[model samples]
Target chain A: MTAAPRPAPVAIDDPADPRLAPYTAMRERDLVGRAGRFIVEGEVTLRVMLSARARFGLESVLLAPERLAGLAEALARLPGDVPVYTATKPVMSAITGFPIHRGVLGVGLRGTEAPGAPLPGLPPALAPALVVGLVGLTNHDNVGGLFRNAAAFGADAVLLDAGTCDPLYRKAIRVSAGAALIVPFRQLADADAILAFAARHALEPLALSPGGGETLAALLPPARTLLLLGSEGPGLPPDLMERLRTVRIPMAPEFDSLNVATAGAIALHHLSRSA
Target chain B: MTAAPRPAPVAIDDPADPRLAPYTAMRERDLVGRAGRFIVEGEVTLRVMLSARARFGLESVLLAPERLAGLAEALARLPGDVPVYTATKPVMSAITGFPIHRGVLGVGLRGTEAPGAPLPGLPPALAPALVVGLVGLTNHDNVGGLFRNAAAFGADAVLLDAGTCDPLYRKAIRVSAGAALIVPFRQLADADAILAFAARHALEPLALSPGGGETLAALLPPARTLLLLGSEGPGLPPDLMERLRTVRIPMAPEFDSLNVATAGAIALHHLSRSA
Candidate 1:
């Protein structure tokens, strides 16, 4: 990979400038399809966007000039055509309209792939795969956290259903510490589709349930494993859990609560290494 | 212990009623000491507040009439003089000032115990104890999540330094799924004091860090252990970490991030079992 020329910085004084429109419409971007574009918030995620391993193609960056000196090296990594726009604090606030990400934001293009496209091919020679699957995970924080865990524990990939929120959601990216940008994930129609995808990929499925027949400590990750997690209250569907090998994390009986992400982390750590 | 007679339900139509003062003072109660009282929001926490195991005293309950029928059995457990005030949806919203917890709130008295009082006695004959120690964990969400994990994994108690926030902070309690009330926790002067208390309690101190001398996967839970965790960026003070046995959670190549609460959860799960 070759480094692109550092794009010259441009100054924008008006919040009403059309060039700053993408940075301004964070919430609406989620509602309306982002026209092949996605948003990156905060310096951490911004740096991830500038990294060579980032899946999306960065389109441009909007920054509060104060961050420029600190991000000089990262900014040098921007593609030649990707413009760097600077706005003073007041104008930047008007453009972003929120006190978040500390005046650093990057816009990237998803290319032809939708947020829930087919899985990317695994890194070369990668075997003994371990992955995470999610169903009905609507909460953004949980989704972000799961991705963060997936990255931390070296999961090969993540699989999600339509019921799950997009991991690219800004709040989730922040909560994930930008791991959402690095982890490879695919979204399917729903639980059935996610299971089918796992089966087709030669990964054995394991559903996590509080009523599971086995405890997590007693189970070991299969050669190619896909661990399925559901949102906190109503876990994976009953029949689905019945069909798949199931395991439960032992809890203090009366306090049988664990955040979906926390549960996923413990499971991932247990299965992170080859069994 | 005998049950106190169930308190009579009172109807209050106005938001300005003096009896509703405590409910209206949510934020202020935190800034100014709450005078031996703490608030519990949502039905789950209210139920916990009503539980026989609750450490605090239930002073009164305020509910939207719609929630009354559903909570009847729990109310039967309320003490004799505790008032159950019912307000219409409009009055409820006016009194609460925020649309959270779905119209259910219970005010409980901390009694003579401050939010950070000394530890309660351990259950009789309970041996091989495990606890979580926190330093500079001020984020309510992280603090709440840690408490939730501690409860789920059967952690005997939680110890916090002066830099930490109170677990009873309403937001923290909600995030903990009300486990903040169920689990025993105490606050100390600072990190040094937390270590001092651990020494007094016979809990061998171990700190968690990504740069630790040992990895969690290779470590075993000692008979009695106190696992220490710090906020994300700065982590535990280097000097302190250098002083204690430090362990790390192994991660993928460059993605080294894990949410503090998530980190605490993983460490607690690993050390939860007897070795």
Candidate 2:
């Protein structure tokens, strides 16, 4: 393959520069939510965003001058219109309000073409698919971990209920090892809406519950299956539980429960292996 | 069964009292390492520590008065010599360097009797057992999550290399949801020791690698399998990889990798179910 031409890095020294606004006061803004755009941190995630340009549009990139050389190949792949800003470590830290250890960040616009829709398409091997429907999962770490597991086990997509945390949140994206960027996901109107979507798609909805259901080993998931999971505690609401086929990972007698992410991983592994 | 009589809680009005040394300077001391004693937080872990009395001996209990009534049963079960100290919320926070929102804590000694040894014995159902052997896994969260998954899938034990973080660290204990307290585990002398132990016990050593080995779906673990996991990024050291039967969780193309804990959970779930 021919190498793409290297673009000259645009230097930004002033932390207060208007072009660098997105990099400032990150922690406080992260709390209020990302509004429309989301910050992608670390080199691995930045590369994922670059590769996923068609899905998540790159706004721009801010990196330490030293990292610019290392990311040249990825930077070359970014769209010509996207600007690449380089600054010293101190300048980057001043703008970010913390050390940008990996010294790379990409701001990307959320995918718009398939807004509020499940993945438009999946690879043939990933089909006869397994998908996760998350309800009331407010924890970002769990959300990220679940997406990572979903991607690892060949689950086609993840469907998040309204109460779920933003998959694009920086921490979630980082924790997911950029699976949030790669795995197909969309927010739904509510838990009921997820159930309806599964029904319409002919995807059998299986609710994962701590209370005993069919042992995972005995059950053979259909061609298309939707494994529903709830928040760590309180679990799937009673009303929702009554509506779907419940399945449980038979755990040891007295253990409270596995981490939601770990539980999701086990379930996905089972469904994927069976498929 | 007749109920055992409850032990009266000792009240402490001052956070700085000499008796509260374990509660004070916790964050700093935690960083320095817990000199054989570790903090168990929240109700679930405290209960686990109490039940594991033979493995982890309780040093003391600190609680808010409101929680005392609820824990009467557990307190009655605690050994007669273990002290129970109650303090108001403010005093508890002052002692702990943060809000004791759970209103409870238990200090326990690391089980010394079985140091560097595999779990002595396990129940019949869990016998054809699966155990996790961790190498160079410094992340405490991953350590705790692995223990929790091990417990859920009925794994008999967790064997950690010396490079691994202490499973009894407060964050690990909390993340494990107290599994670190309940699961039998010990720090091995080194990676070589873990491999030797697995061999001596007739435990099949299967190393989990991202570089793609035998697909998990196509492989069945032997009677006593040791699922070996390493730190997420560097993965199992090349030298160690050459020594064990390497296996990989088949993942989607181009995605980074699953979290180490999630990978362990999937592997453990597979071995346990297959058994």
Candidate 3:
């Protein structure tokens, strides 16, 4: 597809092979240090990485021998320069210090940063159709779910406050169904910075709160929308809530609110449909 | 307060005390073997258990001493006969065979089942506003999220095919924000049984598929609606899809579909708003 031949598969039996260093002790290592490199696990996630070669740099790939055949179509799209490593299940498990259930992993460079040029995720640019922002989202799974929704509904980018957890966290990436890699994103300094960026971009910042001026269905979203969602408990800070335009998803009379990610999905879907 | 006292806290020094047996080795035990009993963890979930005492029976509660003050209001609502077990942090961890970070747990009896009574999740009764049915969902977190959305939107009940994971799974209950304890639900034999029950109750069955008859926005749902969601992969079986009305959540071309639970939440919210 890219006029790049499929890379040759290299077999490595030793668990201590230095080529697999980025993947060792995966549970303990964050995998984000050293050139913004990170691990992408599972075949489904790897396919996204393989396809978006311009957005992410392909460092290398490690797969259990049997998985290679299944991944041939995706692997063929890879540039010939990248190395494809293969190992038996036990060796792969020993290297990662966990059971190799998914049997596929890749290392990629986060390529969004172009130094001296304005940052991508926090740019001073024209507004796009949709963007999703997160404030103080500590849970990796929730971060992942939100990204999946943002991408599914065709959000232009995802912005996160420094208080939020890393979207690049391996579990978050896997849980996101790989949307974290495919969808463009940037981390602002804090919640206020997110609002400021939206202001500069002429983007409408809309927060989803349990109590707000209007219902989700009533809002006619503008051309470029910055849909902000907060943590599950102790929601958006009082000061921030006062500053933004707020909307609520009506629920049963005396029930708890929807999970943060689930609410975001409904809101994103509605905005996408309305737009 | 249900004519109940704050249920005096009984200090438990020994981790292996008989009263704490149900919570022992919690990581290994399923906690649903005998008498339909399961463990509810965290202050938020225990509050739901205490509030809906009629739907769930309280066998015993294990708490860390420091958590007692915070739970005073919820504990007061429990029946006077229920024992509130308190242990030091170390003992609590020892009793659970894992770090009891939440420092709160309660054993609840699933009260939906009555002797020879028609199962509540699959009753032959009048149609209600909304119902969610799951087919072949294997993840507990997804199961819990579906229940959370169902309750938030005031769905009448949730029905699970046997292929779906147990909502009573400890993680599911926590993910559900305790909706698993408060919401009415029942497990049926298979996917077909779910469809059959919808038919008998005069509920319109709607399935979510990527390639469906119409977009979600275009659908005019029925008065008594049954929304069905399948696992993330392989979707609802073909025959079931052909037999029922289908709607799709529009996504960007060539992108993967939304997460099953996230998709379900969007559908439930739409149905709730439309109704």
How far off is residue B23 in model 1, in Å?
A: 2.3
Error of 3 at A58 (Å): 1.3
Docking verdict class for candidate 3: medium
- The worst-scoring run of ten residues by lDDT in candidate 3 chain B lies at B119-128
How many clashes (backbone atoms < 3 Å, residues ≥3 apart in a chain or on different chains) does model 3 have?
0
Best by TM-score: 1
Off by over 4 Å in 1: A1-7, A96-101, A114-118, A121-126, B1-7, B99-101, B113-118, B121-126
- Candidate 3 lDDT by residue in tens digits, B39-156: 8999888988888523677899988899999988878877788899999878989988888788889988765556446544443555446888999999898899888888888887
Model 2 whole-model lDDT (C-alpha atoms): 0.83
TM-score of predicted structure 2: 0.89
Backbone clashes in model 2: 0
DockQ of each: 0.87, 0.70, 0.74
Q: TM-score for each prediction?
A: 0.93, 0.89, 0.90
Q: Write model 3 residue lDDT over A1-275, tens digit each, in one string.
A: 44756657999999999998987988777644444778889987898888852268678999999998899988887878889999988999999899998789988876656654544443345544688889999999899988888878888788899989888788898888888887888888899998887877778999998977789988887778889889988788889889889989999876857878888988988888755
Comparing 1 with 3 on lDDT, the higher-scoring candidate is 1
RMSD of 2: 3.4
**Candidate 1: DockQ?**
0.87
